[model samples]
Target: MMSSVINALSVDIEDWFQVGAFESTLDRADWPSFEHRVERNTDAVLAMFDDAGAKGTFFTLAWVAERYPALIRRIVAAGHELASHGYDHQRVFTLSAEAFRADLRKSRRLLEDAGGVAVTGYRAPSFSIDQQTPWAHAVLAEEGYAYSSSVAPVRHDHYGWAGSPRFGWRPVDGSGLLELPVTTARLAGRTLAAGGGGFFRMLPYEFSRWAVRQVNAEGHPAVLYFHPWEIDPGQPRVPNAPLRSKVRHYANLSAMEGKLRRLLRDFRWGRVDALVEGMTA
Candidate 1:
């Protein structure tokens, strides 16, 4: 691994049931009734980061922050960056401009108060920021977020900002927000999604590794993200999940931790804030 190439590592901190996969089957009000696996699962991730001597950003939900204040503090105490993952894991586009602004404000306050640190970064739930939600950038900047890693350029059914930049760039029509789309790679003249999530699990681990290498070789920082649930195979399953949701959410779960270990060992990992600072400098 090249010592100079430090990629951004992030985790979207939400419980298994809170994931969008169970949106159809699980109701938000019923969240309290389900098992709260985020604390234990996130601690497992913290231990992995410690073993690797790596730091990352945790884009945690305010709902989770209020319920698990100690976990937020624990992330900060371990030298990891903490950022808002919005108030209730709702998609940004799904909310009105006023609603999104409120979400950002409330989440930032909760995270900052709980983590005892400034929250300057955000990642929208499920990367839901798109052209329809251009107002999001200005609102995010106005609310004091310094940067966002919320848009994936790839075309997915639920979310995507197709033709967006794969690396960091400022919006021309949106706002002064510094946008860092998920890391991707060009292969055979077509851009492929490489930044972790379900894609990281669905694809061969070696392919994910190569995609990051490809991005770095092109002199761009690769930003990889994962959910703590992705590493916990034994998590309670969302029974009666739709076929598509089941396939994407449960694919190769048992093998994810090993791939994560390889990722931490094969590349330099750092916080998203560090990358932003470097870019600004």
Candidate 2:
């Protein structure tokens, strides 16, 4: 396949149960016994990226950093970028500004200390920055984050900033923050194809390729993200999960890694920081 120059690639370093859709069914406290879950998931991703000679960002939760310090170090050691995915996987909008600030601070410290790199970027637990939660940007700026990939920009049943610009700085109204929304392909005055999470898992390979091409056609970077759990089909299933979420989380799990391999092979990928640096230069 031909290689296309793509802007940035990112990975969310959370396990299967920690996803936002499953939050009601699975609690953070229940993750301790299954803590090692991320090791295999992350390792598969790292190895895949390694084989494709691609380096990208890994946004990890502080809980993961504190529990698996070695994993964080290993990601850095392997020449990938590290960023914070918050302390717990709580949605930023769900927290008060104080709590959100605390989450960012705690996660920032843990990730920086463990990974031995400056954690300048953050992604909220889910894409929790919607119109109602504009304060999230202020708190993020206050916490010293350089940029965020937290707003999905599509109208999902759970989260979205539907009318937000797909790319560019929003001024955060007051916080002086920059929001780097996830990749979305607009259709008929609305966003239909969003490349991330289970959406990445659910879409066909050719469609994803088309979506990225669409984003690139606009002269902006396509910020693609996925959790490690998306590739791990063997993960223990959460009981009483809503049918839609379960399918979104677990559907076509075995094929995802291969699809990702095709993505890496087809695109020129780099860490988000590298893209930022490349832009400024």
How do the predictions measure up, each by TM-score? 0.97, 0.94
The local distance difference test score of each candidate is 0.90, 0.82
For candidate 2, the per-residue lDDT at 204 reads 87
Consecutive 10-residue window with the lowest summed lDDT within model 1: 169-178
Model 2: how large is the Cα RMSD against the reference?
1.8
Which structure among the candidates has the greatest TM-score? 1
User: Which pairs of residues clash in candidate 1, taking residues 3 or more apart in a chain or in different chains?
Assistant: none
Error of 2 at 14 (Å): 0.6
Global lDDT for candidate 2? 0.82
For model 1 the TM-score comes to: 0.97
lDDT tens string, model 2, 143-218? Answer: 7777888887787788888878777574456654567888889777768746666777887888888888888877
Provide the lowest-lDDT 10-residue window in model 2. 168-177
Model 1 CA deviation exceeding 4 Å by range: 1-3, 172-176
Go through the candidates in order and give the C-alpha RMSD of each one to the true structure: 1.3, 1.8
Tens-place lDDT digits, model 1, residues 1-281 = 36479899999999999888888889999999988889999999999999999999999999999999999999999999998899888998889999999888899889989999999999999899898897888888888678999999987787888898888988645555698999888888787788899889889988988898888888888999999999988888877999899888889999999989989999999999999989988
